[model samples]
Target: MSPALVNNSVISDMNTQENSEQRYRLLIYNYLSHKTTAEEKEVLLDWLKQSEENRKLFSDYKKIFDLTVSSDQKSRFSYRKPEALKRLKSKIDPSVSDARRLKIKRLKYYLQTAAAAILIFLIGALTSFWISRNQSVQNLSITKYEVIAPRGGKSEVVLPDGSKVWLNAGSNFRYGADYGINNRDVYLEGEGYFSVMKNPANPFVVNTSGLEIKAFGTSFNVKAYPEEKFVITTLVEGTVKIEGKGLNLSLKPKEVVVLSKESYEIKPDVDKVTTTSQLSERTGRDRSEKKEDISFSKSVQVKSNVNTNIYTSWKDNYWIIESESLRNIASILERKFDVTIRILSPELNQYTFTGTFYKETLEQILDILKLTAPLGYEIKEGIVVIKGEQKRKSIYDNFKTN
Candidate 1:
């Protein structure tokens, strides 16, 4: 298309936006003036059909108009115009160009014309709109979302922007409930797997603790806790950027970025520890996306491997530990059950464990722990107790001694 045509199209779009607001005001005026001619009605219908946006604007205008003007208000008009319109008025000094004196009119008539007359010329500049007077128009654009998982229970929620979140037992997360026309954002606590919606233009963002993960659209897992110092972000598929404190790193699929708890930092590194899901996705060959000359390979590898199932274990209603320090492992148990676990033997912290279990009750999980280590634990009320095996080294030892 020629520049001339492009300019004309943009001008037309602007004109259409302007015409929408004008039509709304006109509709209200016609209703008030009892001048609803067939031609005016046809014009209204035409505008409504131009775009769903036009209908939304029209409906919003009628709501505000009816709310501000009623039977009692019929005798007097008191139109304050939207704040956006008022600001535009100050920008264009309507007093200088379009000022006129009319004969004495009733309060309602004068009020209606006073704002409308000034607003008529400035409508083009007031594109940001306000509707719903009961709730600020801004509130309706985006809402707040919050989800919490109780002890031993977990939650799964799909956000409005099409991102899926899995909250671990005893964990919670909050997000801007509404994904606006141009952007999506969320906040996380503990750990969760996110299969984010893809939008090549606008990136999805997850903010947690001091870390920020940004991606156009991809699947990833983030683990951040206020009680704990470290924040770990693992990329399952697609690309992501991790930024926190004074550190920032871009990651590839199969890579994990661990920001240090003590210094809140990460030395630059490339990671490539494969996941089960990543293996499943590399199956369908897309000719268009593949390049013959370029190598399809990993520039960097991961610090460790993550079983897609165990890495995303919270999503599957199980806790799997693979050579994980007992302290970190217990913390996961704490978050899942919303309880504090005191390690009577902090030396147990030095021990790393590897184990997997299906969905088990809280008591069952703790029992499993006792079988693997010389520790006795019990849940009284909601508190969990971690004790050394007294004089008995194990459940068998206690039985033998008895």
Candidate 2:
């Protein structure tokens, strides 16, 4: 099969960046099969030199090529030719005899090149790399697969077990090589929405910052950005168990749990202080009368009867914000639009807004916001500076006093 036949759908579904990625992938495939032209080899070499990430990705593909297209595999493909060739040719359309002939010629070409095109498709990045037929991936050194959504864009990833994950901007999701074969656990940073495949025996776990969300089969959204003070888990459908240090909670559909990071950070200090208080009480120092002001504790709040869409809607094109403060909204807009936002006026942070944005540009959203409040904004060099309209602020302040 031609590389175009294998990557046509992939190129169509992805963005321009992904289309370029597919082109390079084909180049890599051609290069490994020893069919690269002089120009294609230079292009691949230049891409490899661009970054460590590109080099690492190319290295992974090279490893896959070495494993799949070895001398023994070549001999086997050469020996078991009749059945496989017949099965491949059967898929060709009877009406397009010329096309069928062309495909058959391509198949023969692949045989001459010592690599199978269908094998390339099967071992592509979209699917899990099956190292060997006789052994499990667990028996081999684990190869970690990482998918990162850039700061300005979101990414969709399909796991080995058909579990789909939509990562928000500036997010990273990863899993081990033995993902579907032996385990179904994934690590997440930033935020991701998961629509997991139903596997009752094998549980799916999303590991965040010191927190583990275990689900048998469920759809849920996890927001665990490092800058944020809380790790939020919102269950959309089915049930999920949230577990961590001094925290274990089960969430039902439409329920959201917010775990404070301060609680996790102060556990050791809290334990020490508690121990000291107990010792003081045992020593008869009258410490019971002197109350220690320690504000840290295991702060886990589970809110019921909530609109889960408010939390999970970020993954979609239209984002719905409900009574969110300007300060918080700025952060969301920054991630969504991939811009730097700065709030100049402290009073603007006090104002809250509620709106549904439908793929609006940064300027359009800002225009709508200006009508709701005495807000002024300036954009230069991709940085947005938001301030209060001084004249309007004065009128608003007077109106508030009255």
Candidate 3:
């Protein structure tokens, strides 16, 4: 064949194919709108039967048709493409500024607009779908969330698994998005009162500095401050499994466990291991050596049938103290009132008191304590200075001796 004849034939075939594509597109639109004549419908049906690709293409157009037009649009056909498409575009892809993408002229004026609306809406929908997918992927990489209750105030938080936590003053609590899914674990620093929701399969675990309190269905209180010498776990209702270094205890209802922070360790030259309290009692030991020899305590003391209110009452309006030391109570008062306490008289730390205080001011509480013992307090710029009244204390001491 001649080269010129071959080129002419190829051009004719390209024009015919382009015309065929436009015709088929128009016919499909007419069929969807119910405006196709009997002859046009026959032509479309024959074309659909010609190839599986043709049928697939028609099916794809049908999906766009169904989404853009209402189901019952035969009798009162209302075109809602303009407003609905604008709303979808603004909400999903307002930043899309490509004018060429929106200039699609598939059908006549109304059809043209409808086609553009459908295309833009699809792009927006797919874009939002991908953005949401990326967001969920990013969330999986993140770890946990920390919630804090600063000094002088308490906070009540509801966990993702429907468990309730009452964080005491100067407390920190943390959990993650996978809290209720993979595992129900929470990290607590300082004191917290937990009312856990029961899930037999996914047990709730409280991770403190020195202990892990696991509960299947229970309510409990944990006090594990770093500066304190002890980590106290009090069980109110249900059972809890407490685990620490060389200590594993299952607490029953109305029971309390105290784990001392001072571990038993042997001095460098000494053969026998002694408790931290015993080491502190040593007469001639250097202060630096004592610190170096101390380790995390494994001492666990469990008391059954104990008063749980005394330990957990800080959450309530009234605080109950049952023979608690004044030195220990100073820390509680500092956290409760958001103040610094300076106990100048070292002897006053040994003073123990048992009482219940309800809505008492700091000064009022101090006054009440003064009435009970030879104790004097002075408040200066949010700091409370506690000192012993030597004269009165001496008189009381003489009276006791007599």
Using lDDT as the measure, the top candidate is: 2
lDDT of 3 at 20: 65
TM-score of each: 0.52, 0.59, 0.58
Q: lDDT scores for all predictions?
A: 0.57, 0.70, 0.68
**Ten-residue region with minimum lDDT total, candidate 3:** 105-114
Q: Write the per-residue lDDT of candidate 1 for residues 274-389, one digit (tens) a residue.
A: 21223222213442232221113222123334444457655645467887777877787665555678888776676667888665655777787777777788776567778767
Off by over 4 Å in 2: 1-139, 267-298
Q: Write the per-residue lDDT of candidate 3 for residues 1-402, one digit (tens) a residue.
A: 233442333223435777767667766877787766666667788989999999998998898887786333431113335424544574577454233231212111111101223211111123222122434656555455666666666666656555677777778777765678889988999999887878999989999875678998777999988777677899988989977565566777877776665641311322122332333332234433433423333254556667677777666656888777898889988877767999999999999898998767777788898988898999887788999999999988998899
Candidate 2: deviation at residue 269, Å?
A: 14
**Against the correct fold, how does model 1 do in TM-score?**
0.52
After aligning candidate 2 to the native by TM-score, how far in Å is the CA of 26 from where it should be? 65
Evaluated at residue 179, the lDDT of candidate 2 is 83
